[model samples]
Target: MSRAPLLHASPDQIAAAARRVMARCDELARVTATSGRIERVYLSPEHARVNRLAAEWMRELGMRTWQDAAGNQVGRLEPAGSSRIDQRAGGHRGPALLLGSHLDTVLDAGRYDGIVGVLMALEIVRLLRMPDAASERWTSGLPFAIEIVAFSDEEGTRFGKALLGSSAVAGTWEPAWWDLTDADGTTLHRAFLEFGLDPGRIGEAARRPDEIVAYLEAHIEQGPELDRAAEPLAVVSSIASARRFQLVVEGEARHAGGTPYDMRRDALLGASEAALAVERICAAEHHIIGTVGRFEAFPGAVNVIPGEVRFSLDLRGEFDGERDRVWGSLSQELDAIMGRRGLRWRSREVHAAPAVFCAPLLQDVLRAGITQTLPSRREEPPVIFSRAGHDGMALGAIADVGMLFLRNPDGVSHHPDEAVSAGDVAHGIRALAESVLHLAAEPAR
Candidate 1:
């Protein structure tokens, strides 16, 4: 690791750059599936459009840009001393520092959730090489190259599988996933074909563990802790362990008017009781959260008793063991609730990702960067745990990961009202740039 001298940009410059990042996010927000809101999903035309626009920006920074086999838009900046284009060559350049987040958004998505991370990375490079001649000069002085990625799918809104793009890069793509389908019943394979991607070539997207020096992600704090602290940013300690399940409850359908209250076997009623149990159980546990975000009832007519109910459970905790314990309790609660209601219940987990801890060395660099960029009074930055899952989880499979969380005043995310302040964005950009320089200076591990 080379410990390079720290770099700083004036507050004015940072503010200007921050405005640019915001403007770009606003521009990309317009490229969505819905005319009135943001809804870019994997393999959608809007996804293609956003990639084109982001690629144009990457080109402007003089980075070699390409769409990886998995549909991620990637940009590479080689070190100034190296002329090699391929990192896998026998004459391979040193492992590049990885930067980025997913570009795809959830339904009615917020503009900054993942978009800001990619733009901030671009801005970091932009700030570092502000002098046109210095771009190459700075590149040559670095020990390793830099790579920016705008991952294609992290939301899983369209295909029901999160981290598809990052998982490919992590070499964790499952062959079984090819059979997964979207709302229109379009399989991932068919979607790849329609999007001009060859499903067979997905293996080409994988990056060896040695290919990345470290992964750094700058994302908004999807929760309200930072806002309550009145801080713009903090270093992430870990990503919460998470599990998602589709729960079903079944009972006999009957005429609502004819069914006696004492003899009722209502699936919807049982599910409603189970939902409360989830909330009640999770509420008592520290740092544990459970949400029933989606719900549906069969035989929905007002005159008919619901025969079946399906609901989604998203449970998360700071630790996997704790999370699993909560799941066990919730399962028992559901079983008891079903028994009392004389209904049948079942659950199928759709997703499970363990907690990922940020690399300590990288965390130190991030902390230093924050101090150097923000000129904080404190030597150590507040380290917050992310309850929300990120592309970092997938990337963690291949490389050490670090993260910086920018404050979202209301801590609201995954909704249309999601927002961030320009000042906080400026702080985030400067901190990210500083972290890169800190990394550039470290000796090879």
Candidate 2:
């Protein structure tokens, strides 16, 4: 007649579990491409190794595990002991709620970029499977199924295209991408074959909108905001829109001894000024960032004035219109600077991605999870925008998506120096676990 009270893990147990996740992250980091450093890219041997390890762990938790056509490691847990593969009329089984992040790493990556998210998802599943945590309100089993996916490619460091793994699952993969080549001259198609995957079957990875109840990802903040606020966890509002370009400045080469400073048309000087202009313009606008991350001069001779210079521009903002607006203004400044310096310049668009906003309903669910898990905190959890791209950007196409960000004490990522305290990871795990429980109790939307 009455509902049984919900069970929650103690703070001490949550902290110990968090340490396990962190230690597992370090263990997986060891399975990388390079011997001493982390460089596990898409479809590489190290990628395969990590997937195998994750699959084994998934099976240990009573979930069926398999590798999807897109090279993602997938694990599915049906409601407790029920064996129905799909839901039947008047049955308790339902569409799954997805939780996970990519396992692939960038060059010399830290132990907890994407790795921590997948581990946290696994921990959530572990909590769900425990007898004490299970709820009896659903009659036979939990209302919805639980699925964990460790995407194979999110960094795109090998193929120069991000979200390949998620795109496939979202049914947004482009056939033309198969022809893309890596630095080693291997085509994506060829690499797929080498990795024992059939590229032609990638479409099979796609899931219909109804197949998933929702998607949630746990990731590091990858910025200083959370660290500065002294908070261990936060909710993501939206991922920033980003555009990249290559700029080339052309000018006549001249001898350093013969050319006067005022008379010489130096491409390097023009490019350098353009880079400064980008910073100055972006600084004027809030939440806009423009970075000239790469630059090079032709001939590179100390005695000769540069004939040509190439540089990269990466612009990002909280909204698409704002990002584009900043780019337009920055371009005009670059045009004026090049013209005044008597140099010709051109820019080629390399990549572009629109921002993805988290679903408001899911945001409320995660917020409740954070609140219930960290009742000691007086203020509401900080909602921040992600300046970096993630697999969620692609997953957003097929399902409503939300994100939880853990604090990075050093605010560093993609390097060995990147770090997250075990205490924070414990908070992340508890929050994620609570989020799942909260979602399980809700009616299907």
Candidate 3:
């Protein structure tokens, strides 16, 4: 009957708790809102004050946190001193190991978006209650049953409902999105019963299959792949397949003093060479992507000539039949670049989703915790491809999902000077406190 072992979280104490969760997420990115296209935050009121300071930093780290009533934001961590040696090592389960992310952002986010996976799940429960690297079989035992959600709107930015609370904890929030509407039309069932909740209990916010088995997320490769491989740590493997659209071009407006540029058929000059051939065919495919973000023109005039223009593309990849053959070759190369400039087109889909792969046994425990917690930098484990998007894609529709990427040292995210480095987010939270202690103390079944 000897015990006194469970210790983990050094990498300079998860880089000083990831610089105190990036200075309390830069004081919630200088007070929340800034604009929306899935930004600033949703389910507003500064997303319930960043879900009440992520349930008060998981009850100031003694664990046992909360917020659900569909505001999500959980925070557990009870192994009761390693529950009878992880239930005699069968891994006594009761639905656990669920570290989450996404606490509303986008209009002007970035204090480590999704607030660095809720402060790396409260610094992996203060590195398993501090002993510092107990693995050759943790006897001071805490063999999994840890949690730390914080979801509540991934980035619908405000009721657009993108993975909002991982689609109500994977119940897939689709009661026709409760008569959704916005742009000041407001509706997510009258904004979740005007924020008190219970639009017929919206499927009672799912998550009950015992309570959740495994879901890890630690975002921000938000783009620029660790500043193009100056590497701060990434281990995502996948999560790409996307699609979005909206293309309208029409033509003929005349009268910038009676149109003259070659007798004008301009629709914003055929939407500038079909938005630069959809960014050169998304860099000619291979981890493909094609963005246009947004565009518009119509009689938006300083004299008028652009009858119409409207634009958008946002393609993606990592297969879904090569993201539907690069969304049908970027709509047949923007309809042959707007039919050789005759201009008259229209496309629309607005959304499509698919792609999420991580979990080769927790990416070999986050590449052996970045080679035993960062060995002077040639740590190799780099494969970034999550071109921004996740709640680990609705907890990869239940079970086996993983992600961890932190290297956005000013690369940009949603906005407000989106930065990330205080030593590359405390070295990606000491490689996510060694992937939450080797996938939450494995061996329990």
Candidate 4:
């Protein structure tokens, strides 16, 4: 690691940068599908609008901006004296240090979850960019180029699969995803075409390993850990390994009044037991989490017994082995409960992602950045493992990934009430900017 001195941002500069980020977030919030709530999904008109706005912002900073084949809004700032003409003519293809987060959001989402990261990246670029001799071109002093990517579809709100945008960048896009449908029955392939994208050109979005130097993202913590500690920032050690499942419990449907207690086979009751088992088993393990987010029972009539029940399970853990073990235990408990209740149960895995640890070099840089920003604190900056999924999970396949988390009040996310303090956002911007400098000081890999 390089021990070079970092150029720290002044307090006033930090505050102004943070204000710009907050205002941009509010600006993007207005371009949503829902009239009142934020709900920008993949391939939606809102997505296109945000992309245009991001591209415009990137251009304002004098960057070479474009929308990738995957619909990700990208902006690149090359080192000083780099020829823009050469870049456009395919003459420059050096590895770039990538920074950004997703632009898409879940239904009725908060403003800061992914939006802050993308905006913060822009702020960092503004802080680092300098006017060349001509005063007409913008460039950086760092050895590598800086590229900001506002990923188009990390939430998967419309297609039911997360990380679609980053997966494309990481060259991990699955062909079968094209067949996936939304609530309105529009296929992903058709949606792509309708959005003015050619499905056949999707492969052009995949970036080779050598093209990217590393990936760094600054985002809201989306948890209460930092808020509870009364801290503004933390270095993320790793993102949790996660598995999602769609489970079904089946039994015989009968008339509620005619069915005797001894003769009744209640599938809902069995499913309820299974849900409890998931909670109980995961809660017993350290750093493991289980959530039953959705549940439905067949036979909507109150007078009729439900013959089948369906539920969704979202399980995650710090370690893959521990997470899988907890899932195994939960499965056993579910089997036992169903057998005793005269019901049958089955589950289909919906999504699975392994844990992604931050690169040690990047983690050290972030720590130094935080330390520089908070010199009054005697202790080292806190380190936390993210329990939520991130685009880093997909980008990890192509380059080293690191994340700096800003405190989110009450740890609320995926809802309208999710929030972050403006002061915290200011500190986060300063720390993240310093981290970029620290990384730049290091010798080229």
Candidate 5:
């Protein structure tokens, strides 16, 4: 006798809705890529256009949706029996579910990184609002409400400050956080104000205590594990811990020809050696993941030895202890490389987030739903780690959070070539609907 998401929704209706969503992903991929990082999103201009479009579409969904001072778009679903917005969310008396993801992509992002969740939420509401015939005669009076958000920042591709929007809602945003700046001296607070968002209203974005009983976010599994497992949709049990840092290597600039191997201290060469050592150290310690994704070398002359080099180091794992251990090994390798190469090296920690564990109740519901949607895919569920981060990480600080990941086959994201199978996209939609229904049906407080 539990109220649930409208499980009565027919397969045909589900398919149609999913198809529409998949198509939108394709469309947005094109549109979002154009703005190309307007605010540090992989495609700035595209991110802006997509954000505006999402807000417009949310309004069209018959829900009063608006953007907050932090630029996080918001939409509300009132209780079935009520016509007015409930102002008692902080009291945690009312029941509601939150669903969403980011709109920004990494530099040269593909179509499906954070955009899928926004599209899925829109479709779910679309089906729920349709009349029986159009809605496939499905309805649920589960006293449930859904809150959709397209978080403005997650990748921190612009100013290297990821997960800003989600962190703001979790009551963690601060002036110091806003003080962060990018390479060009673009302050985060200034960026917010320039975009017409207010830093002063940051407190208004905080979600109330237990106001949201459940949070579900859908995203592409940005890893090779799922692809290797032959599974697409994964009910994430936990998110791996991550530590990011930038290493700066300094050496004397001199004529490449003049700086003979016997006397030269090539900073770029030292940094490259350190990068491999970092990867090797991870392998030596166990299953740690490491990447030296960004690197820049100074002194452009073809014959000149580079004077300085900087690179980004990202290390992640299924547990925190392992992450820390890998960091220690990386430090050792960096020091060893600098000493042996006679180069000066230094590093600074950029960000840190612990692994997140999913709610057992909700995870089981998700696993069941994935099995039902694609029977063969049940035990074959995708078990993977998110290389790229999301706002869900910030939400983890305040409450239990879970994510449903669809297949990212080219296994690529945050790039122009990222793609998800239409069939896999359908599986994702079915899984979300099923999970939502099951969770809503339960009378758990």
Candidate 6:
């Protein structure tokens, strides 16, 4: 079937669409686990609420919707006269272009992190389904169908393992994850059961490698780069590689007043020096970041010396080798600091994910879309690498992946102050919709 030409929305219409998205985001923000902050984790009642809301919106646009076994909210608008089975049988050439981002968020997350992407997708569907100037449904039978997925567990706040939802769809879910537990000591297995999901049927959520044409995600630029440059949108080049560790420092506990300064083996001091080493080392390298976000010193009494210290480290970089090399340097620094303080330390890796690059074809399409949307710009849209993890990392294993970034003021994210302007969101919607049309116009592989 031949694809229909895209029907571009007017400036006023685009603004109105953006307003609807913002309103929906605000509406979803109210459906949080915490009383005063946003905290919607995987398989919680909040997840189920948002999934129902998403399904309702999808149905309003004449799309078919369902919740996958992995708890992902899914919607599909098929090519006119085509069925899901027909699209699946087409293998790698399947007539489906997947668009979406996660719905789950970290504890105390901002409203737009993943919420904006999913809502923007719904607006795109609405725009596509609109009657053209001639009052005809020209876009009803595009060559490829559109599928939007609201992933259930990208934050890993509940189970301590990120990408659980997308990993299932990507066919990369590990059986060992079933044994993972939450803060309440509920195993993932039990959570699934309590959530009305059958663990054995979880595999049903995995889509065949050949079943999707490509995966595209829209997200906020969780950094200051775009805001500093005064750009509204950018094409994402790749997601960063990352490693996380839980580290412990051991020393002898003693009375604070009795221990002489020269005889002290302060574990807290050693851990503090290690955190500084991470900052010093990572700052010297390009696109490398290391953070010690968690810290604790054993023994509650202020009059006693801290005997043990525990901390968390999160390291990320554009390249895996560079990141790992920096880790080695940081490790050596930790050893020196501990040895000098007469303390010992060890680490357990909590998470690791290699960088994932966007497909060149998708990148080109994004650039073209940006150029078309911002016709006055003589230069190409900026391309950036994401420092934060995303659902794209999991989907990259099964299908070509791409991302578009909307600017957030001051680059603040994972916090309540995280924000995006209505003007910027309007531009993002246009660019993303144009990108979909550009991809549709490409010849079938």
lDDT digits (tens) for residues 43-115 of candidate 1:
9999899999989998788877889899999888777667646644112356888999988999888899999
Q: List the candidate 6 regions with Cα displacement exceeding 4 Å.
A: 1-6, 81-93, 132-141
Candidate 3 per-residue C-alpha lDDT over 59-147 given as tens digits, one digit per residue, 9 for 90 to 100: 66655565665678786655544443242211334667788687676664556777777777777666666653333222335555677
C-alpha local distance difference test of each model: 0.89, 0.86, 0.71, 0.88, 0.74, 0.88
What would the TM-scores of all predictions be? 0.96, 0.93, 0.35, 0.97, 0.89, 0.95
TM-score of candidate 3 versus the correct structure, residues matched by position: 0.35
As for candidate 4, its clashing pairs are none
By TM-score, the candidates rank as 4, 1, 6, 2, 5, 3
Model 5 agreement with the true structure over 1-445: per-residue lDDT tens digits: 3223335567787878778888887777666433643223622455567777887777677655666656777776665665555444222235568888888766666767788888988887676665542321125554667778888888887777778888878888867777888667878777777776677877878886467777788888886667776777888877778889988999878988766798898899999999888778887765578999899999857888988999999888878998897788788878888899899998899888888777777787777667667765325455455655677788887777888888777577666767777777777887887777777666667
Give the per-residue lDDT of model 4 (tens digit) for 115-146. 99999999888777532322423344677778
Which lDDT tens digits does candidate 2 get at residues 1-445? 1122233567777777798898999899899878889889999999999999999988777667888899999888776555546433112255788999999988989989999999999888776566443442222246777889999999988998889999998999999899989999999999999999998888888988888888999999899999999888999999888898998999989998998988899999899999999989999998999999889998799999999999999899999999999988987998899889999999998778889999997787788888877788788899999998889899899999999999998699988989998988888888877777777777767
User: Tens-digit lDDT track for model 6 on 1-445?
Assistant: 2223254678888899899999999999999999999999998999999999999988787666788889999887765455434334112224488999988999999999989999999888877766542222226456787889999999899999999999999999999999999999999999999999999988889998677889999899999999999999999999999999999999988999999989999888889999989999999999999999999999857998899999999999999999999999999999999999999999999999999999999998888777777888878899999999999999999899999999999999999999999989898888888888888778887
lDDT, residue 104, model 3: 72
Q: Local error of candidate 2 at 183, Å?
A: 1.6
Model 2: residue 189 alpha-carbon error in angstroms: 1.9
Q: Kindly give the number of clashing pairs for every candidate.
A: 11, 0, 12, 0, 22, 0
